[model samples]
Target: MFRIFVIAVLPLFFVFSSEIFTFLSGALCPSCNCESAKPLHRIPRPQLRPEFLALENGTDARLGCEDVGYKMHVFSREPLVVYFENFVSAREREHLLDISEKIYTPSTITHNGGQTSDRNTKVRDSEVALVPRTEGVRCIERRAREVQGWREEVWIERLRVQRYNPGGHYSHHFDWSSGRGGWGRVSSFMVWVHGEELEGGGTEFPRLELRGDKKKWCKFIECEDNLDGEDSKDKGVETAEDKKGAVFKVIPGNAVYWENFRSDGTGRGYNETWHAGLPVKKGVKVGLNIWSYGRID
Candidate 1:
């Protein structure tokens, strides 16, 4: 009986050995959620609001009119930077501008413990609108969350819309906060809404470079500036960035998304993620900031 069983099992083992090994390895191996396991690349995402959940009703759903057909292109993989075209619709841009105008405050910067004007033009010189989660805002939040493919422990910060006049700008800075702000930002999503004839006001990441995708990148960034771009003021004076990083131009309805932390699961800010909002040389510019965070350490 034993000889017969061995003879029968020998052919079966040869035929399904690979599948058996794969199944056994997966079933007996250490679980991915173990403490020693590597952290996931994606962040935790929030669930959708009820309105978005009613999509089964099709065209009658509240989201029917808000449907967008945006496309995403990867610019960097190490720090995970991506560009989104047509992320915000024209009607949504108008709505954001209207709502922001009603609630914006002159954003201030600190200098030697004293307050500076929103028009300082030194660090961040722009009016800020900490928008409440309205219908439009919620729709955006839902879209942002969906785009990221996150659905874990959810924490999305308030949407901040910064209004920049001709001379306005946000200087070099990192979005991640190490101290009082808690576990720091997980990632950042920024969108542009420029008025007619808007110039300059591009988001510059000095240390980040673009070496490939030449043709596709032109639509999202200024291709003429080499690896690092230099934008001149209205008077032909060069801006601070001489030759280090790349600049993403103010393309209305377009967005820039990047991970804030290093990929090691240390939850530390990646230095390459540092960026600045270059000064606005001409017309008005409004930018939206959507920051996401994981739970406290």
Candidate 2:
């Protein structure tokens, strides 16, 4: 009786197992057609989009500063003013002037009493044009950030191109604002973009005094000539014999960088950073002001 039961159960198991195997095989390879049961190969991956391919290949094409070199001379340490020779390339200067030729408008100063206003003022008599962020302009901005020892480009404000004609000047003022809230300018880079045989237009820091070699500074500053005795007392003129500070001449491709904030925790404006752009007495002077702020905004 036990052998008979085993035979019956074995046949039923074989028949059921065959049916299960056949069902699974059909589910997995429905299109096998029974001619071959070979494993299916993976479908070829879709080709990457053209934009994606371009992005993958662009990492090696970025610009570098390997060919750029510049000279720096310390003008003052208290307010941290440094003069840079050949800060901007000749081509960059020409490009800036060409792009901004028709965009110049009367320049405005920060409102008195720490208010915000865009009205034109006599305090700043030059015309200004904001240089758009083109590739050339971006290169100059990056160079400026490197010179300042800053790693981030966002700290820089928009580049300002200023045109000063005869008698045009900016009265003595501090670059950093005295009010609270948003960050004020921490430093400034003023570049002389164009000036040939330019006279009288110079950046004067009345509160800063330098005892360095006069001849050496002559290359970067106007150390040879003193302000005319009569002009020294003029209300608009801040630098005179009685009031002595370092004054940098307007030399093409050269720039003066000065720190506007104190080192203290308060981050207040440094008194020695007070400066003015003297009247342009001769040829036209075109300058670029690159201001770096404490905050990115």
Candidate 3:
């Protein structure tokens, strides 16, 4: 019986010793030259230095913007569409509407063949106002750049505010231009400044397939029951009912960010990024567009 007990306990001791050896090997400081244990000393608590205190206060102040209450939802991976909740502050939205009250003019779109034209087309029926780059607008632009993972603000274009009435809508078009300029639109951030009582007026992406639960995304996107039907091959120039894509609702203070270029280093526009602004069926819808150009990263 004693020999049997010794055999059982000996294996237990070896297992415990192996675990201890592993722990000690990981805990030992590699830079320490001496193998002997050093004498224990009472280390004083670190006092708050002037610079350390200043840094702590500065960090708290910098984090104040985080409490504004916003959430990000990735709607699609390819062509990269992201939905943002409460992306704009109430003060910012009010300021934008107040400043652009009387400046709206008829909106225009680039020709389908990429030619410059002066003729008014029926494709886009909204009025657009170019928002001046004020301090507040610049702050919003900085936030948009940060959300798109861009470090520099030089790639951002001037903000354009669009006010859509019941019949206003913009047909499918690519934001990136194949013009002479070396820079192309890499991403777009469209923020809903108004649209509390509005209906319809959702941004639609025709080629993307919706994934996950329909009920959950219905809060931000206009998910339909019948999406199995094929979309129009003519680049979504037809009405909203004719197109079968992910349509994001126009919610106030919310925004949608999407990458326009392909991730395969070709720097060409993704064909799936073709989207349209659906017509507003009820009240008005005010939205702000912030386009980012140049290297996306």
Candidate 4:
């Protein structure tokens, strides 16, 4: 009996010792014997410095961000589309506008066999300006980086501010046409910097299917673009949201984020993400894009 008891206790002791060794080594999870995981997909964190300056024009902003009330409203699960409220602070928006002066030229398009076209074309029309990195600019970058959940091989592109005057538009297009050397755009964030007094410039993803409270969603989406009684706000209603698509309203301080690639770990451009910047028909609208990439390596 004593020998049997010793044998049973020995196995238990060895198992407990192995777990303690694994924990102390800090190389693998003690319980699962797998690699320790790092945190990702964090919330945005804005720069709170009392004074921030723009690197491009030396324009300064006098404000601090103790906290950001930016809220994410999910619109899709497969391709991961989200709408953010209060994504940009008022002071940062002003700084972006100040730096854009004299910097914008007639926008052009590059498609099909290296050909280029001016903003008057039927597909796309908007003046684009690259945002120089400043403290204020970095504030936005930090937020995007946090929200995007950085990886070792992935990096964010420099911000590009786009100005769409009345009649400006961009037809359906993919942000990641193809991966270059195994790298490609994986996510996109479109931030509305300044667009008050503007109308008819909504971002639309014609392939997405959206459904929610009509009254709440209309404030953020172009709900009136296409709606029928079949797609009622009431529950248990047989709806046809797939045909209606998703159109985001042009709201100041708000933004839209979505995955540009397939979610199946392929890093391929998602066909369902084909989106368009609807024509601006009434007033000028200024927005910014934060694009991130993924690598196959």
State which candidate has the highest lDDT.
1
lDDT of each: 0.71, 0.70, 0.70, 0.70
Q: Answer with 1 or 2, whichever has the higher TM-score.
A: 2
Itemize residue pairs with steric clashes in candidate 4: none
Worst 10 residues of 4 by lDDT: 48-57
lDDT of 3 by residue, 18-125 (tens): 676545653563112223322222223333333211112223323334334779988788768888999998998998998888999888766643356443546888
- Roughly what TM-score does model 3 have, to 2 decimal places? 0.67
- The superposed Cα distance between candidate 3 and the true structure at residue 194, in angstroms, equals 1.0
Clashes of each: 1, 0, 0, 0
Instruction: Write the residue-wise lDDT of candidate 1 on 168-225 in tens digits.
Output: 9888987765412224466899898765688888898988867565655767776543
Clashing pairs in 1: 206-245
182 in model 1: Cα distance from truth in Å? Answer: 7.2
Cα error of candidate 1 at position 150, Å: 2.1
Candidate 3 displacement at residue 103 in angstroms: 1.4
Alpha carbon deviation, residue 115, candidate 3 (Å):
7.3
> TM-score of each candidate?
0.68, 0.69, 0.67, 0.69
